[model samples]
Target: MVRSAYERGVTTLTLDSPHNRNALSKGLVAGLRAGLAQAAADDAVRAVLLTHTGNTFCAGADLREGSGSPAELAALLRSIVELPKPVVARVEGHVRAGGTGLLGACDISVAGPGASFAFTEARIGVAPAVISMPLLPRLDARAAARYYLTGERFGAAEAARIGLVTLAAEEGADGGTGASGKGVDALLEPVLDGLRRGSPQGLAESKRLVTAEVLRTFDRDTDSLAELSARLFASDEAREGMTAFLERREPAWVP
Candidate 1:
């Protein structure tokens, strides 16, 4: 579910589970965690790029995989936030729910115009508890209030304006490559090039300086948040929402 490769001081971890829109199944989480570990252990790898193979960066958790464990999801976000090396998210597709947490955890992210994002948990009768550990700190308060409540999709430009994404590039604007592989490559190269110049210790320490408070928040709140998330997933309301989603209909509680 994850593929890794290293070159020019960056280790790229690409989520490859297109079968379910690259959802965070157990296998994908394990693969992602392992990739982060590998990047941290390698002195030559100064940065990590988190990208995905399919059109959807990640559709949050795999509901078919049995609601998934919120604790596991929390741990993955924590890993990304606490990693000694810098992590950059290259987004050129849709991201939803927990996937947005990954963006919050990353030090920097670049997205193409084609990308769209949503916090869809509320529509499904749950709150964005687990992801809130990182997301609350990254997103603008007003933007968070709107998206978290409505689960509405927004464009990359809006994401950039709200600070959820570092930059958003238009199609063909990135070195005339359009919004494809070459375009993403063009967007990533300069960032990675800049990262390569920082000493490992400097980068690590700088990351520590930035992430300290957020990490503490995670340590303190993850258990309660995971419990809250799990309880919601098991609720009758969420069951109705999930069933309606799969059956192509509005949830019973929807007005």
Candidate 2:
């Protein structure tokens, strides 16, 4: 599920399905799309803030739910890229596989020390195909190659250094300032304030400038990537990988 709340000039979309660790199940994807659509239509909404409700921002697609449609996933990422208002991601949890694609789609992303990220598709006998549209152009080529190939998980600080996130809040920081002195909210306050101050047209145009290349990538590669994703998910290797993962054992290829 996706929940929404508006404050100042930003509409916050919270991914709230912790059952599957907020995986991209059909219901969750539909909820997110509706939330984004609502934000797009709201004249008062200057930006969108995307965050999640649990320890894992998302654990990629829900393998139990058949992973949804690759084409639909591609469209969802494209919507985030083509959103007229800037989209910001606030992460204080682990992000894996397809979840990392969301970080790439956002205009700006802030992750606290609690946040970690990984392109885990390779470990499951698939490539990070569809996600590469938003990621490849933005990430450090060398780092992308290393992580994508090895399925290595990296923390928020490393994520920032590699351009996977805009900022990594201090380890001492809490998701909100509350009991902690300076934190994730502390890091995001200024940015959100700045967005609130920006003129509607200016913010929209500026967002366009920043997102154009990503949109172009979506246009040029979405079809091919979606095709690749579908093919991979349907393969026997992926079957073994998913089964091994579900059964808590090493896949045959691992030995």
Candidate 3:
């Protein structure tokens, strides 16, 4: 579900499960974690790029699986947070729920004009419990509160404005061929080039400087947050919400 390629000191991990909109299935999560490990071990690799192949960046956790550990996803985010090399999220489509955690964990994220995002857990009768560990540090408090409570979709522009995304690029602004992924490449090149210039130790220490607090919070509360997420996913209310979602009907709790 994840594909990796190395070129010019950068390792790119692409979420390739277009069939599920690259949802964070157990397999996908495992693959991503392994990819991060491989990148960390490689002396030649100076950076990592997280991107996806489908129209949707990631639809979130696979609710159909009905398993709610969220530990694996949390680990993946934590790995990104502690990765010695810089990690960049190259977003070209929508990111939802748990996917937002992946985006937030990245040291830098660039989104195309068409990209969109949302915190959708609340709508499903669950809260963004595990993801909040990373997301809270990346976004504006007020904006985070609004989106986290409302579960509303926001565009790439507003995401940038709120500090969720580092940069927002207009279509073809990267001087690409206007193809599907060229725009992302356009935004990725300069970032990768800049990353390549930094000493490995320098980059690692800089990342540690910035992520120390988030890591501490994540380490302290991850277990409880995962338990909360699992409990909510297994709750009757969330069951009704998931059922209503799949059935294309309003949930019974909706007024």
- Candidate 2 clashes between residue pairs 3 or more apart in a chain or in different chains: none
lDDT of 2 by residue, 1-255 (tens): 999999887999999998899999889889999999999999999999999998999899899965579999998999899888889999999999999998899999998878989998988898899989999989999999999998988988789999999988746443443234556888899899999899888998998898888889988998899999999999999999888888999999976
- Cα lDDT listed for each candidate: 0.89, 0.89, 0.87
State TM-scores per candidate.
0.94, 0.95, 0.93
Give me the displacement of residue 245 in model 1, in angstroms: 1.1
Which candidate, 1 or 3, would have the higher TM-score against the true structure? 1
Per residue, candidate 1 scores C-alpha lDDT tens digits across 77-170 of: 9999999999999998999988898899899999886789999998888899999998888789999999999999998779988888987775
Q: Which of the numbered candidates is closest to the native, going by highest TM-score?
A: 2
Report the CA-based lDDT of candidate 1 relative to the real structure. Answer: 0.89
Candidate 2: residue 117 Cα off by (Å): 0.8
Stretch of 10 with least lDDT, candidate 2: 172-181
Cα error of candidate 2 at position 155, Å: 0.5
Candidate 3's TM-score reads: 0.93
